[model samples]
Target chain A: MARVVFTANLHRHIDCPLQTAPGRSVRAVLEHVFAAQPRLRSYILDDQDRVRKHVAIYVNGERITDRERLSDWIDDDDELFVFQALSGG
Target chain B: MSDRLLVGTKKGLFELRRNHADWSIAASHFLGDPISMLLADPRDGTLYAAEALGHFGVKLQRSRDDGKSWQEIPAPAFPKSDTDGLSVSYLFCLETAGADRPGWLWCGTIPGALFLSKDHGESWTLNQALWDLPERKDWMGGGFDDAGVASICVDPRNSTQVTIGVSTGGVWRSGDDGASWHAASEGMHAEYYPPPRNHAPEVQDIHRLVQCPAAPDSLWVQHHNGVFRSTDGARSWQEVTTIRPAKFGFAAAVHPHDPDTAWFVPGVKDECRLPVDARLAVARTRDGARSFEVLTKGLPQQHAYDLVYRHALSVDATGTRLAMGSTTGHLWITEDGGDAWSLEAGHMPPISCVRFG
Candidate 1:
């Protein structure tokens, strides 16, 4: 299982506990996690389900490029990171 | 007079209580979060606060038992079919339907959309009529990069007769409780545009629109270039050309009972938002703009760079008490109708809106 880590700042507002989720794609992993932890979707995505402009995601220590589709490829043992964009917070 | 005040600021929500002549900061909530708008719903004493979290998104919470406890409510958002790629950028205004209609609320937002909730803000839906208006295509932002619905006035005589002010979009009125709408700023003009386009009712930049509660037909507007008054229930407007200390301002408040009486914080418009001659002043009209008075009783007269936002100047229901907050984080309360004033807080986050309950 791959682990997903959220910024400490986000924890200040809502709790997104550290956990491992299943998936080989960023979107699928997020969907798997969002199903268990609700209201977290709104903070990471917008009305159109696109990654929020101020939120950045990473897979295996590399920043995801497809923010809208969140189609970044991932490996089974890779880690996912969610963070507020540098210029945002 | 109001004994309680709710001041939403750039970083938190500050609650002040008044005991006789003294005011104290009783509590603070959502600290370190930008509070964009607030409504201490006079109809039910239910308080709603709009938190604008840029990194995440806009969030909403309501407190029924004062500030003791609050429940997070869903913030208004654009539907997936937003062809223009529109999303709620900010929650600009929140207003009740009327005293007769309980649990009904109206919310205005940036990118210029109006929302409504019939269940005490438990949920909200975009007002389709105003959102889909063809004239909205002409609307653009003022100082903000995107236009917004900044003011909403539900007629006291009839809640169905709703009037709203868009930052770069002109005044709109709905005769059927948000089911339908039309441009109501007929005589209102915009100096930002040229010749014929300046007269277009759709692009007038109304800084704020306020209705006198006792005289529902009388409306006052603080515009981008000057001030305007409407006596025919917002169907038509007439410019007030006599205001001094520079006619440009963002905030306007009217006396609850006297339609002829109103207050404004005048300053230089556009990029230069400083007080004229660096002297903070409140311009008041007691005779329907026939004449004006610049009141600076306790406000800074030297090196005063305070600029009051549209929702920052609030007049309580009694018409005698007024609370004014500025971009410089200065909050002042006037007990004698602008004849005198006193600073309550000199250091705090820049205030976005101030409301009395």
Candidate 2:
């Protein structure tokens, strides 16, 4: 099981409590999370399933590079943080 | 129907309710969020709000109980594609299809895209026919990087027939429910562009488009070049250069049941986008733009530098109530059409759009 946490700013709009889901890869883990909270997909990704320009995701405190594939492997105790990148004036 | 006004602003959404001759703020939601578009469905009385967040992107919220509570829903997004570099900047317009299509909703957005939802805005799909047009390659945004669909007018007589106005992209009409599209800006001119390009069919900059419900065939447009009206279903337009002060404006409100009556707030040319002579007034034409009467009752007439956006002026279904908001954070209402106006609210965030619910 991987632990997933959302930014406080996103919590202001939707109730995205800490989620724990079982998966081998980041993509599979996020797929399970998004299935429960579908509205978060539009804010995090664009039409092509690519990570949105201002959205950032990190696996074990390191930024994920494969935004399109999102195939990075994850361990049972690893943590994922999804946050909106600081943007605009 | 109870009188209410939904005001979208750069900061949040403000709801105003009428009490006798004056209007007061009823509720305010989405504080500190940039509200771009708002609409109230006549069929179910559902209120939809579009917000653009700098970090999170575009979002849609819906309320069924007159905005007392809201729920965020999945918004329209471009399909992931390698070559597509488009992202929704903001939603420009929200409209219901008609009485026949109960749960249908139309959304026009920045980057010049049209989306339709059959399940009341829970999900949306892009109109690929309009997006795939060859002319779209040249559609540039007037204010931003890409053109935006500023207005959408669906024919009440035929829900399949739709007219869309795009900034810097001209007008497009679809007679088969957006299956196909064609340029309908024949006589509309774009004086800002050089010769030949100025008269091109798809180069006109349309600020707003409004159609009279009583006569669906009659359409009024506030073009960046001037003000125009088309009697043959937007197939052609004739500039109404006779409008007093100047025809350069962003907003136009049409009477609900009168085809010949409409109102506009005229500002100076693009160089100076303020009211003529620094006097804020609503210019109305009852005889189809033949002449104009400036209504200034209870409005600022001296040193006022307010500009109304394309969706900031609205007329209710009965054509008796009117509400308008300004970029300077001033709101005004008229219970008896455009005959008289009174300040409803002031000193708030800059208003983006206004709708009477």
Query: Which candidate comes out best when scored by lDDT?
Result: 1
Model 2: pairs clashing at backbone N, Cα or C within 3 Å: A47-B78, A47-B79, A47-B80, A48-B80, B141-B147
Per-candidate DockQ vs. reference: 0.74, 0.53
Q: What DockQ class does candidate 2 belong to?
A: medium
True contacts kept of each: 0.64, 0.61
Q: Ten consecutive residues with minimal summed lDDT in candidate 2 chain A?
A: A40-49
Taken over the whole model, the C-alpha lDDT of each candidate is 0.91, 0.89
lDDT of 1 by residue, B290-316 (tens): 999999999999999999999999999
Residue-level lDDT of model 2, residues B1-357, one tens digit each, is 448889999999999988776689989999989999999898998999999887778899999998989988878777767785577877889999888999899999988999999998987999999999999888888877789999999999999999999997999999999999999998988989888788776788989999999898899999997999998999899999778777889999898789989999899988889999999989899998888998888789898999999999999989878888999999988877778888889887899999987
Could you give me the TM-score of model 2 versus the true structure? 0.93
TM-scores, chain B, all models = 0.98, 0.98
Kindly give the number of clashing pairs for every candidate: 0, 5
Model 1 chain B lowest lDDT segment of ten? B80-89
TM-scores of chain A across the candidates, in order, are 0.92, 0.92
Report residue B298 deviation for candidate 2 (angstroms): 1.9
How many Å off is the CA of A76 in candidate 1? 1.8
